[model samples]
Target: MSTPEEVAPDADAVTRFDDLGISGPVLAAVRDLGYETPSPIQLATIPTLLGGRDVVGMAQTGTGKTAAFALPILERLDIAQKTPQALVLAPTRELALQVSEAFESYSARMKGVHLLPVYGGQGYGQQLSALRRGVHVVVGTPGRIMDHLAKGTLDLSELKYLVLDEADEMLKMGFAEDVEQILAQTPEDKQVALFSATMPAPIRRLAQQYLRDPEEIAIASKTTTNTNITQRYLVVSYAQKIDALTRILEVEIFDGMIVFVRTRNETETVAEKLRARGYSAAAISGDVTQVQRERTVSQLKAGKLDILVATDVAARGLDVERITHVVNFDIPTDTESYVHRIGRTGRAGRTGDAISFITPRERYLLKHIEKATRQTPTQMQLPSTEDVNVTRLARFDDAITAALEETARIEAFRDIVAHYVRNHNVPEGDVAAALAVVAQGETPLLLNPDDDPLAKAVEADGRPRRDAKERAERGPRTERRGRGDYAPYRIEVGRRHRVEPRQIVGALANEGGLGRDDFGAITIRPDFSIVELPVNLDAVVLDKLQGTRISGRLIEIKPDRGRAPRREDRGSSYDRPRRGDDRPGSDKPRKPRHKR
Candidate 1:
């Protein structure tokens, strides 16, 4: 019933969480999490919530909305009362779990406080046990909460506070009826907080129907994309993405990065590939346990991990200040997801970068994202071998400079070098070069320009050499055996693992950082597969591919010295007949001898 209040965009206005009237325990927890200043949404909503007035907050997903509502709730909680006094309803299981985790972190110093997250896919027995033991706060999805309410397992007679997070998403998900039912069961006197990115007609009507004359707070932004972040997208073929990513990683100076992918399997695949390429990377998905996910996030925050491969659900409500880059490995289908994925970086007015991989067919999605965000991403050029070499040389120089700071250690090494030069009657320059070679070890100091597919793929003007779709249609060219362009290499995954040629090619291309032209014919035998690769493949690259996995089995690739393995038992007699098999006089059986 009241006009919405516009919060000042300047976060510096509010220096501390304590200034918002947050209690000592809650402030302690905030400090523990390294949060110094309150966000605009928090500055506007926390005081109002602490004053016991209902609040309607309008903000985007990554604007610290969880903390905005959570801090106030923690400050006002009656820890001694074991019954659920506060309930938070979210649209998805991921959001519910995230909210519960936030509550847990904020109440770490507070004793006698219990929190439970209830959602589908989790055992009901766990919820029943937690309810019987009594909890101070309950965070859950509307459907599961409705089920519990219908079964008379949850009581809201004494509830004091209720919050609906991402209310617009809940409505979009068709949870309006369940949300209304849950709201009807709550106590009439309970304070409510509704937060949404956008308020639709139905949301407005629901607020009018349920909420008491609430104070409205809106955190306005001119655009969805952060101004501090440099947005860029590279037009690359699907097969060339990993190589492009590796080249970018070699060139960009980033403290931490999150590579967003579409599916749970991609998180593991990408993370595994990155780790194989000598990166400190880990994967987080719905399948990963909450504790492991938390640990992985914590490691990223602490700078122990440099890269995190994550799905959208696993990364919900993730706030880490050290995240300097966000890579959309697979572009999101929806614009909102794109916004959320890139929102992980450029937080708190810090500078960051967002790079996306856009295939030719997915170019339309980029246009949609640009239209929605009102910001066009600049076209990015894949780093050339020379560019990577420059970066490598600079890093090598910096390492030497850093080592020079340790005078005693450098002197020791210098004396050893001098002794070697004197004993071998070799020039000091040659000795230094030999020492540099020793220091470089297995990894090459400079990437071979000829082996750099990304450099050749991108033209001088920063456009792909050929259209991705056209190249895909043309397919990989067959290798001429004796011309020395391709050589046979054997991998350990084959028919036994139901491994397909496409899978082997994908694994090799991604892990080995090779292009489509770099691959030759692939033969899938019973126990192992023989694939042709560039004869000039770097030994280091081969070593890296030795750890490449297909169907969860390590490839362990080695040069194929002997002839190709026989494929005599390729087709089984028990296999079902194909459509054409029964239509003509084919050697294949019309029917299986027995049902497989």
Candidate 2:
């Protein structure tokens, strides 16, 4: 399909809120937020949206794109009507909540204005109560929105504006069908705005089918990886991440940092461990109040706190200039998230550092991010205890020198020390040494991180870390199984059929009714693929899968010769290696990145 013509936004546009015909409470809110000018996306989108036209905006995360559409929606909102005049569909619940908060913040002075953010996991009673109370704006994820519509709790009759934010991500998460279904239920004359960082074919088709005479605008963000940020990656097994993270933390020179974890529970778990290890750390998650979150962030900025362990939601829309580092304790699910995570640091012409912990299996995503960003992150080696010790020594020396620079305080202390030395007849150096011991406190002067159980596991039984992870026993694959092992089965679709692992997985999950827990290793070879199924497989499942057509051919399942297929040899996929290709994800249970 041909791409739509881009209406390029003027990078040097001299647009103001007043110039764009925005006034009243919305403008006052903007001024309160200290926004002096509109961004490129805002300049291009706000005017068209305010003029009551459909808009297709293209911009990356952190590009001030939220304000672009939010301001216009607020300006046109009928505060007195309040029956869901505007609907925003975000891919994740975190984004939905953030957008809802932004709407509330921007419409603070607009009397009678009400906004509601609906998503999964939140109690339905709370959302139902808000909707019954006659909210003016509704923001939600596709699943929860569909739920509300199905239950008739959410109404769209008065919806004048509908926004599909992060459309590409929603499509990626298998929400394209849900999105279309929801769009079908919206008012026919609704002003639709679809925004995405990258316009894949599916999103394009969705836009073509829905948006009418759209004002397409592209905000050309600099997608280049900031050279000022040093990016590094560590490939470790899932069980070893916490240990590896601690070692990295010990070695890196950072002022204030954000450690990104996948879940709220992980944030607390990691923060507690870091605190136990003598680091000033706090966990930020959805559980924390807004006041507590702000306090923690303020403390982080003031250097009273050093590390923040945050879930995706708590970290959303967070802008703290003092963030010197960002550690992805768990790898992000997608390339866009990776970009956004690293973007947390390295802002405003300041240098920053980003470190990502990669599991062996997740290497595919790493390669995807590298290709997207066009910069291969340097592979990081685990820091030794000596490295930590040296860094600690250097910092200690710097602190002592700074203390000595305080002339008045040091002179007073110096006289007290001299008097003590004179009275005790102890050598001056001995007296100073005793005080140094006090200053050192109870913290270990040096750590032998090599002796850590986590590190020991990596080197367990004299096996190399890579060997330990790669060869760990999960279960028997089709070719690897002996006569008694879980029976191996062959599906006549493989590399020759251009069948990827995900496609095979989908077929098994959809047709066989087997969950991920039921499956074992999948080996896709040139002509056929081998997968391990249950020993006494269900007759119904086998019957359903007997003739499942894949890649234009009916998939045929059969007993396999008990010899392992060339598993995704990863390095070359075969011993006859020739070219450049490496698969990184090792056999580990990756915690699924629950959206929001």
Candidate 3:
């Protein structure tokens, strides 16, 4: 085994993709995607892969590794030879689909180049037909690819290039055996490329067993978090997240922003809430089509959209120069994900801001993230009602100043004002004040701290407002748990399928557009799991969940008529309190009034 070579990211050395021997149609496609320079991984891996040598790339998810392999494959592709020549294996269906889309984007100018993405949940008929018709490249998950190979429907005998993307993730997901089996079926002399964020023992062994004297390229920085970003965290309850987020939006000055959530359904839920509050916002998730995702990104770049609520997979490889802020609406499960989420901003040496919401139970995750990144995020205090009022007043003053500059438009209004003053025998100042009131509309112009629900929810110390007696009685609310109003539902995935509670929640929330509060107890059993969902769910939402997949198994959800399983029989249960539940000190749920 040889040591991997460290590659310094010199954005100034090779300013453009054309400088790296990528020319003609491929370079044109790259320019069309608004990429002007190659990333560190691309700068090191492209020429090596193009030179026909096996390469092992060590880089993080947001480091442009997809293009590092995709561009070279496209450049060396034999379009006329439609048989599978390149096989790229990803760990999940979402990544496989995203890689497939990247291939399509890079090969836009090439004629007669066909690519197919084979993954679970999708119908096999389409994949089988595409494979039979012939394709230049195939990107798929390890399990589905192995299934195809066993069925004799996928032929890798003619394969020339193979890429194992996120290999460590595949291993962790229990696909090591399947991956090895698939690798064994490929040609002995074919070129191989393995990419992983971290090289564990299993990954190193797999690379050594397959790759032949591979050229090692490692792209890493001294600190994972960028110095150009000012990172901050707010301690807020799940129920208070929306209020804190909206308050931040009101006070923070940002050009463009992305709010990241853990589940796809949360993306739509958050984005819709932002829009209803008069922000130009949109949602992007795996459920969204590639075309719509592209359009939304374009709108963000073009200044038509101000905020985007996106899931991790959906925002992969998203590069926008205008993004000034990244908000982790829900804390990521892993430290690497946290790094990647904040990496969306503070790019190209521009200063950016990253804010995260952390609950008491998730404080340990934050500590892990800070330890991994080697930088502690500053604690942020939510903007006070007076702070927001001050900002509003400043903007109102600026609006009046700008209007004053438009002499031509103001002339007409000036004459009307004077005529009213003369006819009603009113002073000019009083007339002006009345006009200002009319212009401000029905919504109040300033926030009253005493009456504001958001102000009443939190105190100066950022803790939930509580009376002295109640505070002593309840102590500190550490963890919130309850079984809300929900009815039992059964889905055909369980311990047998190695499915987890989070996976089930993600799949259902994404497909059904349900918020986290809509979910209740999730009890995983041997063959099937019993989940509690909102009662009287729409028939359409149920149909959507029936086709959704978790661990490559269809949910096949239906009403669970059986009695609730015994507590001992339940493998796991997620009994978190609903978002709208009353807080410890509050008599009722707090709903903040929005003036925007």
Candidate 4:
């Protein structure tokens, strides 16, 4: 893949890293680092940093933001001076190491650039030695650097630049005082650069006090769900999503899938359950070692594993095209992560799908996601009895067809059928009926004979169809209620747009602030749909929804008056004459006038 700079030349249409108009040495270094274009933050901040200006950058993870300020520090490094010319402070030990590595990548073209990462977890012996050797750049966590400062092992007398990466996260983690003290230890005139995902009040105040009229650049979270993904969300309870996910897997023809959970422990638990159910699934999380994490990701990409239950941090830099689905086993904390989660699939322009499980309590979050992503998730109902039956029949048909195609003993079965028909002297029609009855009885299709089996199964499990074993556990629940009570309100889209019920829900939830549970029964037709929303909607909501469009057509929401109106009432009441007579009064007055 091309470097961020080379690929996105007009990151914000300012000077990209490659086009930064920096010294030849710096440009060469960037080229050697394999960067073709600067990231958005880099393109925005590089020019100012090179011009000796301080900056405040508001960006999120995975945006290559470290290189934005790191490159400029390298450009201005005074090799002859040899003193620490730049100091980068990170919130966490992990981030400090990452920043130090980035600095090294940018300075590879420079000789004797000497960069050191100082953090608390590692031995102090190495850090002290590096500081004593007088490195040009010092990248360390807030606490460790302060300790070194107190011990007089590190010096910032010659510091020219200072960077605080993920400043807000650090502040949240209770590193504010440490950060402030470290800043105090730096040179008074040092150019400070602060980068954070969110600009909370404290962070902004710190930037205002410390930074020198800094330029602020904020990249709002990207809301584009991969167009290649056919995204859906199933409304299942917290306790039931596991069962529901299994059921969905059984019905869906996914080649590979990634299941995202919020916590590391949950990753392991969910993966174990999936494995116990005989799926080719595994767990990956922050607690796992580098080797194991890499191995897990590799297995997934190689198609050795069908499912991966992972946390967000563990799944970083993962790209797999065959990932046909992404299951948000637990909802993401924020919108940005949701975009990244779905982005794992739908790569290389290949079409994929994503499904999320939303519980009743998470309906608000479901609406929030829809608003952020601009797509509503379909409010999935419990699968209906009829729907489940149909799906089961379809599965049964497929199984029978496969058996007939692959089995070599067709003659044996044929002979048995012939013997039975001849011995019983049965009519050919009667024989076929008997065979049909036997075949149907053996299959699960007729369990809920009058409903869609998949729908019934989903409703019974309170999730989507996952795998076979889960279905066994959900066997023979109370039959679902009839779908006949639904009243359809016409939504005006039709066959021209190729819109599905899920798309409609996603659009509404994403755009109209509707939740997954906000909708009732939905009836999709070739050209239009008569969907049911909750009864007795307030006028404000109705008015707000008036003149809206779904699937590129105007959705005129009105009361469903089932038939054509009578012609007489169509005219205004003012247009009809009154029943009282006027001719008699006029005639009596005329007669009196004639007599006079």
Which candidate would rank higher by lDDT, 2 or 4? 2
| lDDT tens digits by residue: candidate 2, 273-349 | 99998899999986789899999999998889999999655787787898999999887644555677788899889
Q: Is candidate 3 or candidate 4 better by lDDT?
A: 3
- Writing each residue's lDDT as its tens digit, candidate 4 over 180-209 gives 777887788989888877777778779878
lDDT-based ranking: 3, 1, 2, 4
lDDT of each: 0.76, 0.72, 0.78, 0.66
RMSD of 4: 22.9
Highest TM-score scorer: 2
Those runs of model 1 whose alpha carbons end farther than 4 Å from true positions after fitting are 222-596
For model 1, what is the C-alpha lDDT against the true structure? Answer: 0.76
TM-score of each: 0.49, 0.55, 0.54, 0.44
> How far in Å is the alpha carbon of 459 misplaced in model 4?
26
lDDT of 1 by residue, 136-246 (tens): 899997766765775678888889999999887776544666688789998899999999878777788888999999998887643367778889998775557777898
Candidates ranked by TM-score? 2, 3, 1, 4
Off by over 4 Å in 2: 1-10, 223-226, 233-248, 255-277, 281-351, 356-596
The regions of model 3 sitting more than 4 angstroms off are 1-3, 10-23, 30-40, 60-64, 81-84, 91-101, 115-135, 138-158, 173-178, 181-189, 220-229, 232-248, 254-489, 492-545, 549-553, 563-596
| Model 4 lDDT, full chain set | 0.66
Write down the lDDT that model 2 would get: 0.72
Better of 1 and 4 by lDDT: 1
